[model samples]
Target: MGKILITPRGYAKYGDEAGKRLEELGYELNVNRSGLPLSREQFVESAKEATGIIVGVDECDEALLKQCKDLKAIVKFGVGVDNIDLDAAKALDISVGRCVGTNSNAVAEYTIGLMFAASRHIVAAGCDVRSGGWKKPTGVELYGKTVGIIGFGNIGKHVARIANGIGMKVLVYDVFDIKQEDLDTYNAKSTNVEDIIVNSDFITLHVPLNDETKNMISTKEFRQMKKSACVINAARGGVVDEKALYEALKNGDIFASASDVFTSEPPERTDWVNELIAMDNFILTPHIGSRSEESEINTVNKATDIMIELLENHD
Candidate 1:
């Protein structure tokens, strides 16, 4: 039996039953154990004999795909497929499947959590408390604040619904047109990106990463935002420029910012990420927007099922 390569660090740990099911199907599993995403060399070595792969953030570019003659299918463990070279996979007749909306609610909830955390200075307050200092920092209320959501997709829609439930006015910005009925359902108003940038009290990004969206929020956009505005990005890394974000925070161009993704995962300590990490107003998370127990299990199991189905069909 050919092998299946599983590259997600949290796969079996979060979805152990699914892993056992795959093993019972007689496919040899090559699980990644390094805790970090596999390097190109490591991926090539591990996947050369694999008929299917369920990947996390590993790069599966054209060059890598060309070398994997045995690979028949690739399943994205989460919503984003930017890491995989779709054109190369299609050219090679390899099936690609992604678990869409598997983590939408989880990411939405996390985005809202970031909003409250940043607005209330929760992290700073906790730190002060730990140091035996007593102080009540003034914080903005989410109620009646304007929340701008970029990308009216599954995650964005959820965020809007939650924001509305909390009495926040929702403004949505997306390139594609959204139906008025849908907008009315959430009490959201469709607006342009420029309007959202300048008018929103809390701006949250939910767009995918692509040529059009890379650095979508940079120096110019930051400059347009109000000084009291807070920006939250739980979307893909590189969507918000880390360097620009650092400068904006340092210079008080904006009130504060929170990011769950960065240009580099587990970012190196020497870069602009290091400087951003030291800022009191800047909050960062280790891309755990979709790490909720329910989301993790759903994504892993769904990816596993897709890989198994594709592998079986390829035979």
Candidate 2:
């Protein structure tokens, strides 16, 4: 049996590369081809005998973590470690690590694209024009506007560079450290959340979704934004309250919004999902910001590296 039973769809977009990496590691690796995420029972059964797992940002919750007696380490594919039950991992001595800088540029680029798609009504306009509606929409421009970034990490910095390239001023606010040199290099301004909310023409969230950031942008924050301002969330879900965002856009408090992540995965007939789909001002992607070819390779390498490090030395 393979010492590692990688959860299915570990690299849904690039399976061949993942296979090669595991082959080179000289350890048994199983490919997950279930066409869906492993069911919890399936997860428990499959991983019960494994020494390590390379996981995505799916749920690695308490009940799921408890079944893995042989699990020595978990290597996350991307930056967000929220899926893993960290407290449980710590208690079980399961070392966890993620790919940090690997996919930042990809996500940054996607966020900017989402901004254009939303501002210009790209999707809506294309469909309209194809259907014989000659409404050449007047879209907002990025030049001479402020772009607010919630987090000042790798992804946030890259977003600053891209947004600045389009002549957009960058403003950042983080509870964590924001270096002055980085601010100077990017010609970005660093301040509190209020300044970002009030001044930004476009607000793009790059922060992790944790206790402090959960629902950080809500009705009150939305009310603070300019009537013409909009928001983009390419980071983790739950960083902004979906209900509040819906209300903000629905009530015309803000111009528009877009998000790659949602509070629920495969959302089942929720009010928020319904509202967003109904609104032409909203753009939603099924969490594909970091699944580019290069990023997938980077994430797989990071996950495999973690597994190799633990399996050969620690275990």
The sequence of per-residue lDDT tens digits that candidate 2 reaches over residues 44-96 is 77777777877775578777778888788787778898989999988887777
Worst 10 residues of 1 by lDDT: 12-21
Per-model TM values vs. the true structure: 0.94, 0.93
For 1-315, candidate 1 gives per-residue lDDT tens digits of 678899998795776788787889888888887767778788988878888889988899998888888899999999899999999999998899999989999999999999999999999889889999988989899999999999999999999999989999999989899999989898999999999999999999999899999999999999999999999999999999889989999999999899899888888787676888978788989999999889988898888888888878874
Cα RMSDs of all predictions? 1.9, 2.0
Which residue pairs in candidate 1 collide?
none
Those runs of model 1 whose alpha carbons end farther than 4 Å from true positions after fitting are: 33-40, 312-315
After superposition, which runs of candidate 2 have C-alpha atoms over 4 Å from their true positions?
8-26, 130-132, 313-315
